[model samples]
Target: MNNKTDFKTAQQFLVDNPDIEVIEVLLIDLNGVHRGKWIPRHKLQSVFEGDMRIALTGVTPDIWGRDVPSLCAKTGDGDGICVPTVRTLKRLPWLSRPTAQMYMHLTHQGEPWGYDPRVVLGQLQQRFAERGLIAVVAPELEFMLLSSERDAEGIPQVPQTRINGRSKVGGQLYGTDIMHEFADVLHEMREACDSMDLRLDTLVKELAPGQYELNQHHLGDALQAADNAQMLKRVIKGVAQKHGYVATFMPKPFAHVDGNGFHTHISVLDENGKNIFDDGTERGSQALRHAVAGLAATMSDLMLVFAPHRNSYRRFAAGTHTPIAPTWGYENRDVALRIPVGDPQARRIEHRVAGADANPYLVLSAILAGVLYGLDNKLEATEPASGGSHEQCRELAGDWLAATRDFEESTFVSEYLGAPFHEAMCAVKHFEQDEFNRTITPFEYDAYLITS
Candidate 1:
């Protein structure tokens, strides 16, 4: 699963899958949206040979696919080479056309593009290598399956049960009966994941009517974990669409129901292959505490990476199984960082901040960076929170604007994720915020149309 790809591999793939007429070379943007070109099968060899080129701006677009004014002006909108990540090449099972897809990264003159989120994660992995540590990551992603048809007012509707075709309308947390109702779609999604070699672990009925969560088995390679998360999202959406439903990883798709979250379970291993966070006790080790402290300290600074959009803020309301403060506790689901009750040798920290909509690469990079910051500085964690009370701790940024400002001003982010990426991210977020500010929502009209 290395990032490198060669012409020989591409040729072999084309030879093996002769029916694959098209190859989708996808580049993940800052907003975690897939953007790229569909190349004829004959042209995929050129992509593997580094002959394929795309604008460097392709990886920095706003959520709407518009170029960020500051970024385009700074780079003169130059081109960068696209290098495929060999492991991601897989046939599209949900599409009618016999198509295959490969994930790619932008490079210039053989150097990794700093603005590429994958490259950022790679850089963080290199940093961990320098310290002789490996961060094992398992990500849990939550999403909703809705009817493709919207209401008359265009609001989303819960999908119908596959068995009876009745509108689904109740929270069935971990209910096997609900799971049976959507067995057809879920089974197909599982098959799709198998084809892509994604390590999907468990599927659970969530607290909302149409909401569900899928967990992935932990991977030693943090980069690949993020890759699997991204690919899994595509699988969920594609399989749902094939069944006449829409799948969304949007954090808070429905205001009243539970929001989707991307929770990451992380553990660090030393060169000797022993978990550094474990000391054969229930309390774990000092290193684990330091990691917790570092994450708590930097949680606010990286809120933009966790809650990236305006709607992303809607998921942060208190007492909704969402962590508002940078609090940590043993086996406490209500805290931002929870130390799971498991075998001491498998001890890990579960980061509960990020929404499913956040870029997996950025979420992972921010997380690993925090772990490294803790390890290097030997920071001490505050006392473990008891009984889920977090009133003593400060809350993370409540909105996108505040997060953008915090990210813009953070020296830690600039130093860790590179100054170029920090600047580019801030500029793109600012542009999006400006766009959001210019629009008046229907709620605004309903509240103030005649009052003023």
Candidate 2:
């Protein structure tokens, strides 16, 4: 399913959906933002044939969509060919106009561009293939649905429930009634997922007002898992807008409420289709411990990948159900790595560190790289925390700046993610950090004005 689209496939899609007037050719950047061009339907054939071109800087933009000067200076901002992924070609169900969208990665002179996030994940996938191992991954993503209108101070407001068009306050964890309040929009989202082939498994009301979590069924291919996650987010946001609401994946939207998270469940299988982490026991096999140890060893260095923004740090406060340390435990939600309590064959590690806003491709790449590192080094994990693990292990990077520095200097990250991509990520992060440090917030002015 990861194969590049052929001309026949593109022509057949056009023939089938004759009404599709425009096709959106999308490229996922380092910040997980979609940057692309909407070409006429007649041009999709040229896109599939690798004739479509976009600026090479499209994949190296800062969070605000500005080009990183360092990356741009190096490449002279040349153009790269866009190659469409056949599986991602789908019609946009939420759009009023007859439109279609497809995800693509950049290629320079017929070789995969190292700066592309999908290509980086693909490199890690090849590593797993070389070891005769396959990683099955599923992501649980949380997001908030807010009103399109803002308050007097221009702050987003919780959307009114469709049941009575009244705004509700307080968290309603797993409330079926709350789910019913937004049934019409959720049904449209589900239909969009079905059309896109995204295996959306469950929808649950979260611990914050207007917050919700959706889980995707596990995929044997990690790349496809990330693809499904990216597409699912788009589907949710698009459908919500069509229903007169705004969907945001921000990690910590409100200071008083629980934040959003992107928890991933992973299980490794051998070439013979057997779960290598299962040793016919509840405690699982040594391979599982190795993977956990690897994740713990690298969590601090890769913190920037998990929490990329200033507000992302706010999601890590104590008692927020966000892991502050690289602790591992059995069925513990407070730890970074959790071994679920289930049948041995279905046993897997649940990574709970990344924010909902993190890039799915990079998250999966970091995770699979850690697993491979642990397996190759035969690392042993620490004793699993019984009750909680936050105090049992050291904390993650203290802030966004610290995390960016850690990521910039990590030899592990450079080696696994490739020097080119590692450098590009560091450059973009540093630029964003500098921009953030130069800004003054309203809170600072209010707290210090004439008081000192």
Candidate 3:
């Protein structure tokens, strides 16, 4: 719900809808967490007057959701206006009372924050527009459905989104029967998406138990599309709560089996409004090859922006749709970049590097910028990737540190995202990495306390 309507207009609409009691405002902080204070409907006046100030901790800094350091809190706790983006205003269907929803973009001292991911994409979109190109993208998102309770082994469990209240057998392909189990959830999701102006195309049950997917429509504008991806997660989580269920886009919520992903499809249209990827020249257009080469060449460097979390790496298994190797193939699922089977007019690269948790704006920034680098450098993609996956891991980097190191050393990456931005992101990621590295995991304790 990034931009439902314009700012001034949305405010005026709320004024007209006097009966609309604004109960909550949603804001995505630097870490992509939703945070804001509750306000009464009458206080909507204060929101419009710029008197609304949310706490700083949500925006400034935190380690795994904790205020481990007070750096941000010391500076007004990173407080900012949950300034009404107005168009984000909506009725939260699940709240106990009438709840209206609006998502706020971040601003510091009334100027768009430079390092903000959303703003970062916005800047890139303007750059693309200058070159007479439009970047349109769609993400196929997948997530697991987990049991709301813990298991006998003290591990969290997952159950199907719906069980049809009866014992069932297996049916893998387009099993429409299972749709009934989760029809209610889908209905709510459709309503929420429509109200937010995000076009929804399809919903299907995925491979893993309780896992389901949502295929987003092709986005018209790049920046808005990324914002829509971020907003959809917020909406899904909010709506799930109403049904006494929890929805999370965390990349690898489960330890084993397949993890969630936001596989992106991207296309670049030229000034003449032609799909730049179209190549009837037989040997493949030089530009398209270069784009693929640039992507494969920079994937290691862009991993943090693509697969950020320690857990995110787990999703890149060979058998599953997620890719373990940084390679491309025509209409092939085995490679990281798949040219999906479709009409020639719809031909584009499908980037499989991202996890569900990756920031959409940042991911898009890395990708579109990488593609531009391809065009600039006139690079060429090499031979197809060797097929191997979770077991071999030869194609994918080993750990987050390795990915970060690769990203820092990338010439293509530094040239696009800029070294300062890259380094700043590295700094933040390293902070988390160090903290995680030093801590002993539950698995280590259970295995070592007496057995060793």
Q: How close is candidate 2 to the true structure, as a TM-score?
A: 0.96
Per-candidate Cα lDDT values, in order, are 0.90, 0.89, 0.69
In terms of lDDT, the poorest run of 10 residues in model 2 is 160-169
Alpha-carbon lDDT of model 3: 0.69
| Candidate 2: segments with Cα more than 4 A from true spot | 1-5, 160-169, 389-394
Expressed as tens digits, the lDDT of each residue in 95-199 for candidate 2 is 999999899999998899999999999999999999999999999999999989989988889976654356355667888897887889988998989887899
Candidate numbers sorted by lDDT from highest down: 1, 2, 3
Question: Higher TM-score: candidate 1 or 3?
Answer: 1
- Candidate 1 local Cα displacement, residue 24, angstroms: 0.5
Residue-wise C-alpha lDDT for candidate 3, range 300-352, written one tens digit per residue: 77887888878777776557667766778776666778776566677788888
lDDT of 2 at 155: 85
Give the worst 10-residue stretch by lDDT in candidate 3: 164-173
